[model samples]
Target chain A: MNLKNIFKKDNIMPVAVLGIICLVVAVLVAGINLITRDVIKAEEDRKISESLSIVMEGGEFEKAELPSDAPSTVTAVYREKNGKGNVVTLTKQGYKAPISITVGIDAEGKITGAVITSQAESHGKTGIDSYVSGFIGSDAAGVESHFSANHVTGATVTSEKIKEAIYDAFVVLGLAAAKDTPDVPEFTPAGEASLTESEAIAIAKELMDGSYTKVALPENMPETTHALYKRQEGGYAIHLATQRIKWSPTENEAIVTVDGLGNITGIKMIQWNVGYDKELLSAAPVCTEEYLNSFIGKNASSLNRVEIVTNATLTNNFFGEALKGALDVLYPVPIYSIIAIVIIALAIAAPVAVVIINKVRRKKNEAK
Target chain B: MKQNNKLSIFLRGLIAENPVLVLVLGTCPTLAQTGSVIAALSMGIAATIVLACSNVVISALRKVIPDTVRIPCYIVVIAGFVTAVQLLMHAYLPDLYAMMGVYLALIVVNCIILGRAEMFARKNNMLDSLLDGLGMGVGFLLALLAMATIREVLGAGTFAGIAIPFLVGEGYSYTIPILTQAPGGFLVFGILIAIVNKIGPKKGEKKRKEFSCEGCPSAHLCGKVSCAENTELVITSEPEVQGTPEGKEGEA
Candidate 1:
């Protein structure tokens, strides 16, 4: 290749122009970065410091080394200069986005405060302040119990995430010794046996007309039908189990009381397992006394006439099936009567069954 | 292209050749940011700074840049200015920087900036290019403010975070949430464009059509008089300014 051809004007001009423009841009960008690097760092430091002050007040904080066994959600830990507490910043995955919170844990392993610094929760940041503030003065066990019982009504998932972050903060500070729980606890599926005998009787006494005795569930009853209580005044209280949400292991136990005629007298929610933070459980329009009351005066056949909740359609359908099974157990069709009915049905369908079988057999023969 | 005075060149972009409404450029940021007044204001300012800076630099280096490599060169310069603005905003105005998010960096790809650079900056004098950039920037800001005012007031029942008393009262709060959404952005953009068309000076329409072909980046290649009328062929000419090196196009 000739040197003249290598450095030809056509070949060189475009390259030169592009090269110069790129070089100039790179330099300008570098210069801006150089100028802004310190300002940006200082600004970030100021923000972190402000957030730290919000969580653990009246302390000059300095960044501390995070514990080796700290939960993955724990992002940063800052120690108070006067030994007040440590503020642990963590970001846990919420329903929609990562919920970032700073939790303040004192030397005695009790939470002083927890503030949500940033989150893109489904229900937004409003109304969650009280939920987070409830963590104040709680040790690890208290935190767990409080979290298990209460949450921001519609933002349950976000609230649960914030609770996890706060609890992890306690664990990071070696404050979780109050209760030995795993970083992520195993969610046990709520069993049908969760409803106690006394609790069943208490619910029965509230709904039924008089005293009742625990009785065996009829043989053909649905799996969800736990136990039946026969009323002395001519009715029965049925204990039924349903999942709190279809996707969750946690179950909701409900008590449905029926008169001797199998007409539902009253229904009550017995136990709502809140292990898995299913917002739909709390946000459901049907999970109310009024809704449960609507099921009253309806028998197995009449249950379908009850209006269904918009989101809890599957649960409603399950309730209907459970009630039908309970009623079947109450009104046991005689074995002889069932056998006679089956024979009569078979006698009516015998000709149609033969014709369908013949048609299928003829088609197979034709193909062969 | 005819030369206009500094004032006319600057004033034209405000209403006649308004980048968002009249010319319909930079629709993404206009729609995305105009959902809130603060966001729209921040976006407008950030884009304006980048546009003005890039225009001046591109104009100053126009003669030095080879025609074949101009687009890439323009992008580099524009990106550099955008990054610089981003860094500055991150440092000095962190809140606004966080609010603007990726839209600030996206100014590099905004058609309005590249359009002005190609049409006015590369051809006009440095002063005129600077004025054109400023005028277009201000026009963009004004357009964003107009759209944002409507969106923030009606959609959110607030003006720059302050609640409007009549819109949101004690027992009831009234708001059309869809106005802050994507469809609403298109609706508002179309209405504004239609309004600008209805009230705009007739002379601006003719000037707009003339500049459409003359300022097109691909005008040199196609040698066309108009985009719509393919029958008319025209000769592409070099800048008649002094000291422009001859035969640079041939080399390119």
Candidate 2:
């Protein structure tokens, strides 16, 4: 039969042939990917480990795992020979995305080293990149004793997040210390702290039930910035994000009062910026509506609070900044959006623009 | 007209139908995970496997799959592949797996995998679908590589983390200041899209396109999660079925 005649049948042979060919082709491709991945994974892991060793006190860095119930997301825990039990590298939410870092500490619960193992945060300034190495050889508590890290010189929020992440590491290790798990077992970094949104909510609920979840710095609250959205009967059902919120709840109306940790972590009812006022704030610059909103329903437990941004106006601004900061930290935003949009726009415009530019040139030639 | 060759499969990813740059199919991982070239490449490959494997299985079982549950079946197959990759990566390539974060799991929802299943694999036999899947995987890889190349060099002052001498570090030559921030990605994406669009066929000048997909998005906002199952496909399928001899058979 002629090759042309083969097309006339529209037979299963074509499909069958195609099927067999495709099966072979697909198996081959997938096989290649699997094999290639092995090399790629080895190469990448070696590189990252090499980078980690440079920042951390150099050692074999044995992998450590947290108890299933203990909260944290770190996958591998490395211990120093001195029983310092430091350099727990894992992931954590930073200014943009989950930032992977290796935190180094001494036996006394102080940060000696901090390094970004891998980061999806803002490009250059997780602070883990810039000043994290400075932490090396210093005590893990150096952040508390030494100068506080300001927002990144260029990338403030990102820098602050890294600093806070270091602090979070300290808390994890410190709590481990206090628990008489004095051997200082491995503590989870954020990557291993895979708490989903609902889990976050659940964590908040637990803190309220007299759980000592908040093992971080926090001070007692004296005054609170309050905002009551609606006038109600038998007292207003006050809205509070969390127990960390310092202000007392009295009926429907609530106050934006609380500086650090606990109930007031995120937004609650009428968030600080939107339905509330910027001018009116607590005497000590009680956390703004945004801050209050953050901890709207968080567990009221132990967490040392400090005056991060004092002054009434400044406090509200801090709240606004904090909420925006929180959202910005949570999402990578325009970076990803921009690339996607630009590539698409350029792709579509290429064909049209080419034709238009060509037509214009043609018209000019005709006129000539 | 392109031949099904190794070079073709590789090159196709670089330009013709990039999952990120060209097709704009899997935007979530591209946007959320690619802070560096390493992250992007790892995600691309992981996703590529899921795409390729799922395509093959779906093709193999096409006859057995009842049309009534096609979508669900496709999802189960794709998700199974994704979960397998996830476990494998977690066990062996723990670092890359960890770096990918929630995005690693989010691969199931990635439109690219589903789009390939619905658009190509479901309809075609094993070979063409295999070719198409490979082409798509490469395309996605290229798009991710391109994005990472830009983001790393400009946004972070490094290329694959080598820290180029004059281009970025100490006595750096150039940089988009905003790109170091989150919003910069959007600004860069928009500008590049405009430039790329300008390079293509001019607006309204012989609209019959060459390589563009029939339901491709507007070039400017191509990856904005706009696709929601093209309604026109559903509408037009019935009419198109009436035109051919196959239509009579289908009708019968």
> Evaluated with TM-score, which candidate comes out highest?
1
| Runs with alpha carbons beyond 4 Å of true place in candidate 2 | A1-103, A107-109, A115-368, B1-18, B33-35, B91-95, B155-157, B169-173, B201-252
Best model number under lDDT: 1
Q: What is the lDDT of residue B32 in candidate 1?
A: 78
Q: What overall lDDT, based on C-alpha atoms, would model 1 receive against the true structure?
A: 0.76
- Show model 1 residue runs off by greater than 4 Å: A1-4, A56-64, A71-75, A79-86, A90-368, B1-4, B169-172, B201-252
Cα lDDT of model 2 by residue, A1-368, tens digit: 23234234343454554455446545764665676676655755775677556645555576666645332545445667657556666666775667766777767666666767655443333334666666555554555444544534555565655655665565555433222233432211111222333444343343232212222111322112221121111111112221122122111212222222222332333323212323444333344444444444432231223234443333243334333322232232524456678999999999988866766676567668
DockQ, per model, reads 0.26, 0.02
Local accuracy of candidate 2 as per-residue lDDT tens digits, B43-99: 889888888888878887787666666777777777667766876775567667656
lDDT of each: 0.76, 0.54
Q: What docking grade applies to model 1?
A: acceptable
